[model samples]
Target: MTGGPRTEPIDARAVLGRCRDAVAPALRAAVARLDPASREQATYHLGWTELDGRPGAGGGKAVRPALALISAAAAGAPIAAGLPGAVAVELVHNFSLLHDDLMDGDTERRHRRTVWAQWGAAAAILTGDALLALAHEVLLEAGSPDAAEAARLLAATVRELIRGQAEDVAFEQRDDVTVSECLAMAAGKTGSLLATSAAVGSILAGGPAGLTAALHGYGAELGMAFQLVDDLLGIWGDPAVTGKPVLSDLRSRKMSLPVTYAVHHGGAAGRELARWLAAPGPAGEVTDEPQLRRIAALVEDGGGRDWAAAEARRRMALAEKALAGAELPDRPRAELVALGRYLVDREF
Candidate 1:
């Protein structure tokens, strides 16, 4: 894929950075209030924060909280009222990341060693559990009018997220990854959290049914687009920026969008790729780097990268279009539109 011109002159990093600073203090306060015992510990050795309470290595772009705030604003909701909800979603997202790194045995995230890699899997799992509990406490204290309803969404979202993770792990063990199956997996893996966020924000705002539905639709499309773009980058992204090896998805035998498309589009090459995937005991443990490179060539030649990017762009357009019918004030409309565009089009 070529490095191309951006559609707009928006600095997503700048926007995300501001949002993080705004939310981080609230989030830390909420966490500290939940379990003072944990807060009192001298050094927990958590991956993203230093013992001195400074940013350790790096956190993330903090997109989940941004989505919560943007959706709330779009529905004409108060930003302060939605603050706890935003913080809750961000905490849950990080919890997922902590565990996901363990599941994938991923070493590097945000250009630093993952929690599981640095402190061991037990510590990582415990940290993830602690964050999940803190998320619930924060949401409950935030106390929206529809707090009960939002709590229900939070519970259901967690269940669905776990189910989605299971589906992804299972997919790695099989060779028959259909396009429809892959879409369903992506929906559960990425869609549930974003959809819940939008829905919770609208519910808190007392939005009309139509507005709520539109926000949900917008978030669903955004998540689909986000995952597809991630898959594309898994094969073609700059390693320096992404902090992951180029073509690492292919090398690891992961069932990503490009490989799934190749299986359906590349005939013999696709079949060979599928065979290699089935031959694996686990992904990324193989002794042969040259063979893996050959598989990446097959996926590239099969037009999988192009197909995934096109699909991502299509979903992003749909996300943008969904907002056309949403009830939003001017400030929100501008920011949310920009946010949606950047989600689908971001480099890092």
Candidate 2:
């Protein structure tokens, strides 16, 4: 007998919502311990409150934490066992975001002014530091048997994240970015934390080492796919959906994967694009909107967009393969598959 269609759609929204609900209390409690100014900035950055501190509806998709929780459940542990890891991963993720926004000079996020833009750079930096410290504090206080190891893993991941950010900043000033270098930077910047997020749940639950390794691999692949999609969005996504200016990455001349691929692979078109990018201003900055648009079109004509999209699908497949290798319970395994699908398949 022939098998039917093997994959089914998952309710990503519901899964993320449930994970957010489960982890929100602990996250809030951690933030509540911050001093008043830091607390307000942190809470606003997390979408827990408006600029004035009233409750608001802005929040992220909760994908990283959901991966932690779902991975824990897949390991045959209670969902509560994953809570500390989930919250810790979310905190670390946001810590990076706050710093990244400042470093990238981004003024907006989630359709609102960024923490740095709204509360000033010092407040944003301090609040980010508070979040990072609090992640460790909360993990250590969880009293899990593996709490120490979890804390160590998160600390190492943070160091790797900083390295990635540093490389990204350095790449902006250079014109000789190889695709391999770009991928390595993406793995460091985006993949390391996600790998930790996936493995932490299993580690905290004291799951088998093999299972934890498998989940880490899965999460890394998923993270690569996620970043590739982000690169696509930076070029072509709707401002309303992405909550940023149109073609913001191009305008800033960010060396996103698609742009990198185009610059390397587009032949004559690539050369033309490079000339425009090299047309720096008095301060060595490229900020002309008309030129930015031309570079975007050149990237498209050179097949950067198609290559990045294809690469995203390839990474998603790798993630699915890694998930298949893990010995998860059927329900949670299916959910993980669904989550992987949702991550790469999103428009925003």
Candidate 3:
């Protein structure tokens, strides 16, 4: 938040870039296999191309794929052994993104128009579905001895993901949502896939069960930290940095972790916030800048902001703890710890 980027023991950006470079070729090839329309949409969504088919300079952190590759390395396998799983994980991540952008009615991402905004809801849905299907295809064709089990794991994770998304949507309409329920939803939506990402590669490489399970636990806790930071950014992150409008989560009256905690425990401020949330008429997007600022302030005053940050730190510690007791290769194990720190501390 202060310096441009944090670089100490490890340059996380450098590490992430390397992972992206390793994963990009196969990811591109898989995207190329989509039908023309879905291909265009997928490429655009992935920041590989512009809306009009030209090259673009936008892309995500590639954290999930990175986790998969590192998980393979941590298991003492060649990183190449993780390629198919990494590609599958990345595809699934984007599938969720396309659908999330559509469902959230977000008009932009990565400083560009969202798929649903540029294309259409139907296009977004179908393209997302194509990606989901392709993820399974990639895994099954991987030829790894553990491919079937990995695919099954992915399928189960997807179910948890949808369950989380459904809970997220349901929370917006109800004012009585609990903090524990919010944590559970965050786990389902974010933790499930991340756990898969961290351990699927180990599964692919036939790693021992103990290490694989440890990596999975690491990912799950890291996911919680990741989502908490994201929620904070949704309310307080610079639009220029986050590629989103200010207070985007509060705008939609989203019952994010911070807001839910504030409403559940903020005393007078929480009561005031609850009234605003439950006001008459559908809780639509709030665009007034001053009002948005006040709501963000109320969330802070109600302890949502501090609570979220503390919880993130707590989760990060737990994630790192999962690695400490495991018999993991030094390099990837350390990298995994670096990656988890970046997730909670990242500015974008």
Q: Please give the lDDT score at residue 93 for candidate 3.
A: 92
Weakest lDDT window of 10 consecutive positions for candidate 3: 1-10
Q: Residue 276 in candidate 3 has what lDDT?
A: 87
lDDT winner: 3
Give me the displacement of residue 340 in model 2, in angstroms: 1.3
- Ranking the candidates on TM-score from highest down gives 3, 2, 1
Return whichever of 2 and 3 wins on lDDT.
3
Which residue pairs show collisions in model 3?
Answer: none
lDDT of 3 by residue, 159-246 (tens): 9999999998888678899999999999999999999999989999999999999899999999999999999999999887787788
Measured on C-alpha atoms, candidate 1 has an lDDT of 0.74
lDDT of each: 0.74, 0.86, 0.90
Q: Count the backbone clashes (under 3 Å) in each candidate.
A: 0, 0, 0
What TM-score does model 2 achieve against the real structure?
A: 0.94
1-348: candidate 2 lDDT, tens digit per residue? 012114556687778788889988988888899889888888888888887668888589888888889878978998888888999999999999999999888788888789999878998899899899989998888788988998999999999899899999999889898899999999999999989988888888988889889889989999999999999998899887887678888877788898888889999988887776676745633567777678888999878999999999999888878877768777677777788788788783
The TM-score values for the models, in the order shown, are 0.88, 0.94, 0.95
Which stretches in model 1 have alpha-carbon errors above 4 Å? 1-11, 34-48, 51-57, 280-290
RMSD versus native structure for model 1: 4.5
